[model samples]
Structures are given as C-alpha cells and as structure tokens.
Target: MKTVNLELFNNPNTVNKLSIAIKNESEKLNKPIKIMHICGTHENSIVRYGIRDLLPKSITVIAGPGCPVCVTSSKDIDAVINLSLKKNVKILTFGDMLKVPGTEMSFYKAKSLGADIKMVYSVFDAIELARSASKPCIFFACGFETTAAPTASALRDINIPDNFFIYSAHKYTPNGVYALLKSGKINMDGLILPGHASAISGLKVYERFVEDFNIPCASAGFESVDVLLSVLLIIKQINNKKPKIENGYKRVVNYEGNKNAQKALEDIFYLTNAVWRGLGNIDLTGYELRKEYARFDAKKQFDIVYSDNYIEHQKGCRCNEVILGNINPTQCPLYAKLCTPQNPVGPCMVSDEGTCKNWYDGGIE
Candidate 1:
C-alpha cells in the first residue's frame, strides 16, 4: 500500500529486471543468505507479488516482529478488556486489534459479552466519541512509530477531551530487532528496515545494526520492485563484504526521518521497557505517556493492573516461533488444520499484515 508509484513500481518489465539482478547478485554469495524484513506491509507485498519465488534458493527473505497487532502483549489486551467491562468506561482501538486473542478473551469476545468496545479508524475518532459521550473513553493505542506519530501529533495539536485517555501499547521497532539479533534469537545476514517506520525514525536508528552486527541493512517500500531492489542491494553488500544501511525506498523515506514527527514523539511520550507478545520485554522499546500528560494516561487514570499469568498462544499454536522468524506458518501444527484467517488460533493469523494471514491469502498452502 505504501508505494512510490504503484503503476511505475509494479511494472512487469521493472520487476523482472530487478528479479534477474537479485538472482545474479545472490549467485555470487557462496553461502546461504537470510534477509529479515521487520514490516508487515513488506511481508504483504512480498507474498502478494510472490517475491520469494523470484529470488534464488540461496536467498531467504523472512518476516520479523513486524505487525504491531501480532506483537501486542496479551497482558495489555486483558487490561483493556477488563476496563471495557466496567460500566463507566469504553475501549476504542484499530480494527485489527479487535480479533487478536487476549489471555482470557479478545475485544470482539468482550464486545459480544456486553462490553463497551468499539473499532475506531483513528485516535481522533475516539476523541470525537468521547466528546459526545458522558462516560470515559480509553483508546488502546497499539502500533510502531508510523502509527504512534499520528497519535502523538493529535495529542499535541488537538483539543482532547478530559474524558478521553490513551493506553499506549505503541512500540519502537529498531530496539526490538537489535535485541533479537544481539540475543541470537534471529540469525540473519542482512536486514530490511521498515519503510513507514524508517520515514519517521529514519535510517540513522539502524546504524547500530550495521556497525555492531555487521549486517547489511536496507530500507524498503511496499512495492514489488521496492522489495526486490532491497534484496538485490543486500546481496550486493553481502558479496562485496561491505555491510551498511542502504536506502532502497528513498522516494518516501529520508535518512534523518520526519523531524516534526520525531519532535512530537519527544514532547508527548517517553521510551520505556514494553512487553511484546512472543519476544517478552525489550528495553526502551515502548512509548508511554510523559509525566506532564498524566491526565490523558489511561493506565494512571484507571489504576489498571496486568495479570502475572498471561498466556500468549494456544496449546498447538507456533505463533511465538513464527513471530521470531524461527519457523514459518505452515510449520505450525495448527496453521491450516485448525488455525485460519476465518478462525485464527493465534494473533499471527488474525491481522491482514500477519504472516499467516498473508501466506494464506497468497495461497502458500
């Protein structure tokens, strides 16, 4: 969806040309090369366009902890669900988050059981609802930098109602990927940074990955050509033994990122340790409301507490391993057998950006 120009980028001639170049570059590498992309939109484009099939067998492109909904901790979901059940409060969030299973239930299930949960397209929508309603409304904000920027911007620019609050489950992408790479949980020779996230945080945040881990990094857009171009660039870096951050989606993403969005983030929120669904707690990766904005902090306003014994996945679900890129969706025992887009057993199958959902929709099976 985030393409420089869909008509231009998705041209058959350009795609074939890029694919040929990628295969040629990959042939130069003696060993198998794994490139992990930490963006759901990238995964969607890759699968939708069958980008993997175009690449040489030596090159493997895997999805990382990209989808914010897939990585949203069950504890946060449960907390919001409990809050929504209360008579005086209502919960609002993105549509993708409604179906994701919490420890006890999902927002959909809670809504079915008479809880005040609603799907809002944007943070401003929640504010509008709060403006007219007599009861308190809590926005269960979940996303990475791209979505977080708007929330921050709205809070900074809009006249928010006193009854409206934000329960931020927003995450910072770079630190999470860095932690996984450092912990040896993800074994990849190259990295493909997120396009939209990179546009906000910039390629500068990923400089440490190239410097410390010696991994080739490329920021890519969500187009067939963009994805292939990034792979080609990474392979070139691998062959030349010159690992650094490369900008493949330079049309939209800047090296320094959006300065105004960055400033708004700094002014509205602070970095703290946040819980990811499968990855546990990664330091300085979560965005929490600042002390000055305590009035709009849902956690502080509601006195909410998370459960110590929260369960992220079902018994047969391999979503944890899948989110970590340890395995693919088909490898899961319940992938197609029991878990599906129609009836998702794990968060990975629920969201449109989810790996399982993309694989299924792309007819991988």
Candidate 2:
C-alpha cells in the first residue's frame, strides 16, 4: 500500500457539500428512500465518519451482510471446533473467529479447553506448520470473495502438504444479496456495492442484477467522500427513475475486475448451495474446493458433518435479523448491555465490519 493523502478522499468540506446536495436531491422523492450497503468496510467508513448522521431524514441507510466472520454459521463454527478437539489435529484460522459465539461454544473457548488451534496470518503459514508437525493441520477458511480469491490461489498455485487441508466457508456477496432481494426480505432503493469485493468480481457480474431488478447500484470505495458521492449518484438515479449500474470506485475497480484472481478462484473452487445465518439455504453462493483439489479439503479429509441438534449458545442474539437488515444493531436487546466487544454475544460484535459492533463502538450510528 502507498502512503497517499487520505485527507483528500475523506475531506470534511467535500463530505459536507455532498451531504447538503444529497438532502436537496432527496426532496424529489415522495417517501424516504432506503439505501443498503453490502460491505463491512463501507459500514466502518459510514460509522467512523458519522456519514449516517450527515444523511437527510428521508434517506435511511441499512448495513447488510458484509462481514465475512459475522455470517459464518454456528454449525460451521462447531464443526471446526470439533476438528480442533481431535487428537494430533491442529486447526488454523484468522484471529476474528476466536470469539464469535457459535451454537455450542466458540473456537476461543475450545482453544482454552486444550484444543490444538493456531492463529495464522495466511494459509501458507498453516502449510509450513503442517509440514513440520506430525499431525494433520486444517485451515478453517471463512470469508467472502475478497479473502476467498487468495485462498483459491494458494490451493491452485502451491504444492499442498498431505496433512494441510481447508474447511471452506467462502461465499459470494452479490449472490447472497440477490437471494435477499428475491426472497423479498429486504427493501433496497439503491445498493452501494462493495469496493473490495468489486475488485475481485468486477462490476460486470452485477450487471444481470442491475438489468433484472432495475436497482440503482454504485460500486463504492471505503471513504467518506467515495461513499457520500456514491449516495449522491444513487439519489440522482432514483429521482430520475433511471436504474443503472455505476462504477463510482473506478480508482480500484474495473468492469472485468482482477481477471487473474477470478481465474484462480475458478480453477480451484466451484459454486455450491450455501446456508447463510439469517437467510438459510441460498443457491449458488457458497464455494467449495474443486473435486480435483479434494485432497486439500478439510471437510472431506476429516469427514466433518454439521450436527443437526447443535444449539444456539447465545440466548438472544439477533445477528441473523441484523444481517438481514430487518433490524438495527441497537434494536437487539443484547447490543451494548450484554454483547460488548470484550464479551460478544453475537458475531456482529466480534468483527470491526459487523453492524452491531460498529454501532456499539461508534455509538448511535
């Protein structure tokens, strides 16, 4: 990354100007327009800069399922925990999964209870450890397209150690969002598309959605000005009754996106039916390792199966509804009182991208 002037992109003067313009443009609407964002980084930028506060009363912004860790199902977490408990088996994952409360218990709890768990920065790190150790090592992978591309690359390019395997919980965000839209679960006037995710998938993949649904969408970057400007563009389209896909984050994203990364993803993984936490079994959203790469699949190698009777360990966490945009983070009874970041009752509070945790940390979105 280069040390560029962030002050220019997050400029307060520009944001204020955009805010006033958005409010003025929003007046053309007979009713309040609800805008939804599908990236956790976008939520962070919105809350961090108090972008929601800058919005007009007529425009409501809802944060959708953008956080990868927040959407990882409890049954998946429990499956990984069970693997960690196996004798001579080591489970590797990013740090965010440590405290995400699963149906039974969290990986953090399992680690404390003497599970052979390792926090690794990358899949190759786990592979190195697996090569050194006598026992099998499993990488518990959970992420959207942003992280999944690299995981796919590691599988396709690297020579896999026999003991190194992956338990994939990778998903495609646009597919998941399409499921929400098709199900009539969320009401979105416009969509502020994910900037980072757009870099992987490119803006073209969303064209079918734009054409079919006629929803105004702008591929957005994670900055105050980028988001605010995208909002202005959306409001313009909505007011004109013109629905088109716009690439507002052209600095980072293109129509085709990172083709090499997409190719790598295609080479090692295939789309499968995925079960989202709130949205149940959505079709053609989840990615599993390709059949050719089955030797590196942790789920297959360990014969891991999600238990039917696994319980919701958190009694009243409304993360599912929160992810669905049906309820705000503060609407959940467990928001700040019981689901503090130090002790998160839900996955929403466990990641910086989570809507509930961002609200709790940023205070009154």
Candidate 3:
C-alpha cells in the first residue's frame, strides 16, 4: 500500500478517494468501532469541520479528557482567585482561563471585584510583566506536556523576583488517560492520541497502554487529512486484530519526542497526585515544582489552604459523562439551553477547546 501524505488530502479528488477508502473499511468491519481522540484541539477540529457528520455511522469518534481548562479542578481556580484578590498580588494566566468557573467565582468575576488579574499569551510575557510591576506576580500555569515544557524552560535561566510565583495546575496526558481507562469510564476500542502532547512525551510512553490494555493507539496531527488518515490507520489495526502504537503524525512527533523540552520538564517538576474536576484525584498524574525550587512555588509561599469540600456543578450538568464518552454534548439538556458559550453554566461551555463550546460555536443546534 502507498503511504498517504496528509497534505495530498487537501485536494478534492484525493479527499474523495480517502472518503471511499474509509467507507469501504467501514463496510468490512463486523461491529461498530468506538475510537476516542484524546485532545481538546481534535474535538474543536471535529466539530468545526463537521468531520463527525462526514464519517460513517459505524465509526464513533468520542472526545476524551483533552481540554486542560475543562479538566482543571474548581478548587485550583478558587486558589488562584484568592491569590488574585490579595491586596499586593497580581495574577497572570492564559486568556481562556479567565472564564472558567470555580466554586464561588471565576477569574473574570474576581477581576471585577478589583483583583489584579491579567491574561497573557505566554509565560515569557508573564515573567516580563512581573519584572516591570511593583506588586507580587503569580502565574496560574495550566496545560498538558506540550505547554508544561515551556513553563519549565522559563524557570531555568531566569532570575525570578522574590514576589514571583507559579500556581502550577499542569498535568500529564498519558497518566490521565491511563487512569480513565483503568476506571472503565471510557469504553474505546482504540485511541487517536494527541499529536502535540505526543510530540513532547514521545510515542514510547503509550507503548505500555497498547501492551497492557491490548488497545490500538495512533498519534494524530491536527489537520483534517491527518485525522482522517489516523482514523483509517485505527480501523486497519482493529480489523487485523493487532494492537500497537502507530505514528500518523510523523512530521512533528517521533519515538523519543523533543529531548531538550523533556529534560527541562524533568529538571523542574516532579509527579504528584492531582485533583481533576470530574475525575477526582488521579495519583501521579499532576506535576509540582521540585523541592529545590520551593522558593518559586506559589502554594508554599502563600498561606493558603485549598478546600476539598467545594460543591460540584449543579445536577444534570453531565460534564463527567460527556468527558468520559458515555454521552455526547447534545445529550445534555443544558447544552444549548441554559449552558451556551455566551453564558456558560459549566466549565465545558466556557473552555475554547471544550466539546460543548465547539458544538455551540460551530452552530450545532
């Protein structure tokens, strides 16, 4: 078989050919195949491009715990909100984080209440701002491996101010996925793994899941053709009864990933148990600033105690079920009714990469 280049799928004729290939494969499969794409960006692409509508009914593509913002605990949001509200402290974070709801308030609401909260495109900007500002600066760091490396890198050579600190809510994607699989929350026949995270963590990390769980896994790129090809590869693996890790996104991702980035992350942060919004506490899935960097750790510097008794979102939110692939975004009664992107009642509606946000923005009514 000829190796398919994702770039070629941009052509109408080539896309038609790929569609036919997928259809033929769909016809050959004995049972409906449920494949989960474990990236929030992938969910955005799927909903925006109407890829789900294009696919065969026999193939079900579900979204997983991909959005870092959607999965961030309410308590962590409350913690950052508290830090921002302090008289002399300034909070910095990526823009999408501002709207995510905590137990009592959001960053936007906190800012309204006279908290010095600011949104930044990158951690570098946050660091530069901290150097210029007179007040204490706290960066609310949140993301998977892809974003964590850069945050880790920023800590390497910089002379951090005495007032500068990091409230890290960064997480590891593979560990979270493994936890979900072990919990049986997701019943996926295979996984269409995240390309960006895989580019940092390497393809080797997923080898254990393939080996232990006997699930076919493929790393996918963000482009439409890349996703289509990844789905085809997954179908081929399932049909052949050979579970393995295949790399569909070869341009950016490799077997070992970016060594320099991995080294930076390992040097600064250590794995620890983390609390996820719907998933509860996942052991060794979270990263914390190393003991050597205690001076820069925000949690240690601030006399704050994050409460675990925060109330969950209102009943019928179905965020937990929607994230686990047990229910679609449309299945929730609050989906477009009470929980549209304009006024999100839940984190799923607020996050740009969230499944509900994707569906709402794409005019999926």
Clashes (candidate 2): 0
- Best of the candidates, TM-score: 1
lDDT of 3 at 278: 78
Model 1 poorest ten-residue lDDT run? 1-10
Candidate 3: worst-modelled 10 consecutive residues by lDDT: 6-15
- Choose 1 or 3, whichever is better by TM-score: 1
Instruction: Encode model 3's per-residue lDDT on 1-365: one tens digit a residue.
Output: 65656556455665567668888988989999999998989988787657777689999999988888888888899877876786579999998889887888889999999999999988889998999999889999999998899999999877776778899999998998898898887779989989899999999999988988999999888777778888888888988899899999988899999999999999999999998887799998898999998888889988766776674475668887777778888999999999987778778888888888988888887
Clash pairs, candidate 2, are: none
List runs of model 3 lying over 4 Å from the truth: 1-9
TM-score of 3: 0.96
- Reference-based TM-score, model 2: 0.96
Best by lDDT: 1
lDDT of 2 by residue, 136-166 (tens): 8888888899889989998888887888889
